[model samples]
Target: MVTLLTGLCCALAMAPKWALPKILAAQDASTESLGQAPADDPRLAAVRRTMEPFGPIESIRVPGGDTTESLVVGHPGHRAELEVLARELPGATAAITELWGPDWAQSALVVIAATPSEFAALVRVGAEMPTEVAAASVADPFVRGNEPTGQRVVFSPDAGRRLSADGLGTLLRHELTHIAARAETADGAPQWMLEGFAEYAAHRGRGHRFAEIAPTVNAALRTGTLPEDLPPDTAFTGGSAVASYEQAWSASTFVAEKYDEHRLVELYRRLAAQRQDAASEDRVLREVLGIGRADFVADWRGWLSAQAV
Candidate 1:
């Protein structure tokens, strides 16, 4: 049986709307051997060094078409979680590749933390990692036109306890989407495009109903409280986080519907390359989607209204 998992983003946290196109069936916990650890690869050794301080570690290698994609790592106590992530990694990568294309490294080091300290270390958050985040994608400082290095998705220790197999797959795809798109995504880019694009990728082609995915927005729509504009970056944190995510996803889905998936991606590329204010967003909207910011927001609100009933 599949269950919903609730892992909200702390800062860059992807709230719990993540679901996926592919899901692995229940498996023997021991059957997660996706591949053998390939020789003395430097990346693998580096990861081991980082994780070993927390405790003795174990891993499963996820093979790609020719080379391989990732290694799922965690403590023996969390073997079951590692196994599920290992099994889910391939399909998640495939989904990201399908959407973002085959340009990225297509590989990662997935770590399941043994404790909060371990989680903090893995994601390099110092101490006291944000408890709201279920999983997050991290990478070394990416240089323009260079493949990203040290890219990994670190899962909180409680991820396994909180997320089901299906949830694991969706969250994996969500974080992997961030890893895949990281290079194109500028730090100060609009939050609607950055997080919304990732949220859109996570749910695309997964047969999720609009209301099902954006229940918070649906609730607001029912009360004649449609969003006045795209969720501002400020909306992504603190009290309104869940609602903000729903609205962001809703705005992105509207783009996909009015234009097409390809244009939606194009829009993401255009808008995510820099910080956006009203005028800059208008320029990008006219360039990519051919609608100005006001029209885009108007159309999105209309789209949100249609989904309410």
Candidate 2:
């Protein structure tokens, strides 16, 4: 099995249901049916080819997105999951655009697997797909200056079983943000910034209270376990993963609150453009946020401390 993990949508998913504002829920009544993928739909080919063996494939057109197309796909057993993603598509796209702007393809493919084998095929992870991972965003390789191709969000077979409708909705937003920002993200970029930015985007404007969004960090802060530095890449995958995700999210949240959403995005663009050492990172932090690396950490720590109460 493939063991290499991809970027963008890897973390614990636990968020309460958020009532969609009326306008966002306008399409809810429309997803009652799903149709077979037409043989000529090129976009469906990406996942449909691999997913067909699991069962007969069914799909629904997402109501609102970029001029191109967006779809949610799955087999019969995954009808409910497919409908949930289809319903969430427009709102999730709007939320991502509200923050990520209109630079991306905006069009996407969301696939729900019926079994672990199907899940691994969709995500293409060589090793067994990790059970804890609920979804991932991937794209066919593209040049630095152009739009990405073959972009899709694949959900594990167990995602719907493990996550509630609203949970899947939050996860959809989380992964879509990754898809939206993939053009700006580079390999070897700092994991803290990458995951933190995604986390911030995921929970932004959802009316989630701080403690609810970051239970691990809140507990650590109240117990006097303040993070002195940003989480390292390894921290995203093991026993420390959940707390690291919370701390990372807090860092991005602090930047967005203390400065503004634009600068938080600007910081992500500059820092994630390529690999950086401490000195280079310090330079970019100062350039974007008008603070050195140490000061950035201090401010983030202070932000976390304030949220403890």
Question: For model 2, what is the alpha-carbon lDDT of residue 78?
Answer: 75
| TM-score of every candidate relative to the true structure | 0.88, 0.90
lDDT of each: 0.74, 0.76
For model 1, the superposed segments whose C-alpha errors exceed 4 Å read 1-33, 143-145
Q: Model 2 over residues 25-107: C-alpha lDDT tens digits? A: 22344444434446678877777779878888888876465365588888877777787787778888888888989988776
Worst 10 residues of 1 by lDDT: 1-10
Clashing pairs in 1: 9-13
Candidate 1 lDDT, tens digit per residue, 80-133? 778888877777788888888888878778888888888877776646576767
Between which residue pairs do clashes occur in model 2?
1-126, 1-127, 2-126, 2-127, 3-127
**Lowest summed lDDT over 10 consecutive residues: which window, candidate 2?**
17-26
